[model samples]
Target: MHTPASMVTGIVFAPLGLVLVFTAAITPQWREGQARLGASGPGSPLRSGAKGQGKGGARPASAGALLLLRSDGLWESCLQVENSELKQCWPVAGSYRRDPRVRLAQGFILTSLFLCGTGIMLACIGVRCWTDTPLRGVAATGGLLVVIAGLLSLTALSVYTHNLPRLGMADPSKAIKSARFPRLSLHPAGSLYFGWLGSCLQMLGGSALLFSFKRPAYPDCPSCLKLRVCPACRPCPEIPNRPDNDVYEVSC
Candidate 1:
């Protein structure tokens, strides 16, 4: 939500997005079924890992599923089923779902960065208005909002991190990995908390700054110092792709 610090936020977050996308794209592209355990070739039932130790052939319950069992302290993968006529090898687990916190964190970082970056672009306009004319009535609130929101984000993140010791598991938070079974980890939880906090600040700050961009700035005319007048027309047309000042007024 922090929109003011676009450049700073954008630079920091873009790399994270790229890293996640690359990891997603390259996740074990090879099919599990075709990959043999312990480099076994065709017709060889035995798998290399400790996971496939015992319970060969198949169980009567499942029709066409690989049965994993341990026997005599060894692991084995069951290739064929004993009962049903169906002939199929055991399937390797591959289901992966999106985590909401991760998604939110990603969005928050990216958005805040964008907002911050935009602030840089509009800096010139703000300066121009200050010099050329009097500040508009509406302009003051937006700038204040951006500063306040950014502070709020920092506060939220700090609170979340402070509370982490209460909610985290016994395992080392740093050891959590992409291949974890439960998927959720204290690392990510912490990251999400801080990430959202920063982003919200950025969103609010950036929004406030964005609002200030269009607000009319008035300055005393050079010749007529006594009478105050709006500065040269607001540079709305110059600013690229800013959000609307409000819901009802659609102007960017």
Candidate 2:
């Protein structure tokens, strides 16, 4: 059986989208910020003797005006000193985890992943190329699920983006609150871009699959199935000449 072009497109792009979204979800770079610390200031974030702070459990800080980088994701957070190998990572907790927006993003993204995975399985089963006629309806149903998953992912991304700066605001350890260097800012990071791209690809793939719902036109031939005849190559039968004057035959 010849596979429809749309089905092939959906098969290719949907998996790629799924991979990208999964990568984004597992990564800890959803949002990142850098704060410059002063070694000499009493309120310095990285002061040698200062207590540990933030959702990521703290380790020792380098004694300098070095930049402190923080990254946050759905499940984990990481912190590192600029240009240094000293890094600490931990699962997301505290007020940040409890935040409504964070919880919403987490739920939406997780659900999206689950739905997309299930949809892909359905699509694979429906794309039975060995059969004479493919299950276009089943394939289309999968496509709809994939499309919904993409939308959910997109919603998660949007919520996280619009509330990026406010996500970890409850953390008292933020350098922005420090008087020494108060200009620290947080912004969307690499993972968000990956998610956005994946969402787009998912939508495109699902739409392509949806097109398969339309039936293809074929020439009328009773033996065409067994002969595996191409519609274009199959010739129509000619009408037989009749001897009866009253008898009439007409081709529509």
Candidate 3:
């Protein structure tokens, strides 16, 4: 049976975190985006620049538009739903893309947020079904899951709790049980302890993925502090001579 949306968030976090959402291996959304980036790789003008670039002075950062080819010809896509008249992020500018380490941190955060969002969506769905299912044992179970979902979300809000590496995960999946109707968990529950457990698992998986990827930090200014210190002059380096005009400019 397809899993209920209520269980989706927990399940999402439990196995892989939301980075899986971007892996294309698990989620088509990410796969499409990856393929798009890959196909356009060399021709991308922004390829020579950062994932995003700052504009002329305060031009604000831009991530650039993606050119996607389909039977319909070429089009620009955004992370926001395509063709949505309401989305402002179309063209997707100024968003941050991370190197492995930072991206790893970000993956966990995004996954956590996704889980919470899904949990809320499912809770709303459950509420809509509440009137029809109150006498059903699963209805009570659903309500409990909703409450638990909210509480688990709050637990994650404590910040950086989701950094656990999956190597450390402890299994409660075996103990979690469902009384009836839409039983979940591998089992189901009224308490949400299992939901929280899934959240923790996601954190670990995200951390592991990040640790596996090497991260590179680009230098913003090669002339900055540490670089400015010449090894030959470490004790006391001679300052470079400057023209009179340079002194005047400095005085100015």
In order of appearance, the predictions have TM-scores of 0.27, 0.78, 0.20
Q: Please provide, for model 3 over 1-252, each residue's C-alpha lDDT reduced to its tens digit, 9 standing for 90 to 100.
A: 222333444333434422322232122121122113221255554354323233222211234433322110001223322221222223211212322322443444345455434533443443343332212233223333333433434343322123222211233364334321112111111122333444455444333222212222323223332333222122222333434322111100
Give the residue spans of candidate 2 off by over 4 A.
41-64, 170-176, 179-183, 220-252
Model 1 residue 123 CA deviation (Å) reads 3.8
The global Cα lDDT (0 to 1) of model 2 is 0.79
Residue 211, candidate 2: Cα error in Å is: 1.3
Stretches of candidate 1 above 4 Å error? 1-98, 129-131, 134-252
Q: Write the per-residue lDDT of candidate 1 for residues 172-209, one digit (tens) a residue.
A: 45544432122322222223433454445445444444
Rank all candidate structures by their lDDT, best first, as comma-separated numbers. 2, 1, 3
Q: What local lDDT score does residue 43 receive in model 3, on the 0 to 100 scale?
A: 59
lDDT of 3 at 235: 24
Ranking by TM-score: 2, 1, 3
> Lowest summed-lDDT stretch of 10 residues in model 1?
69-78
Highest-lDDT candidate:
2
C-alpha positional error of residue 228 in candidate 3 after TM-score superposition, expressed in Å: 81
Instruction: Report lDDT (CA) for all predictions.
Output: 0.33, 0.79, 0.30
For TM-score, candidate 2 versus 3, the one ahead is 2
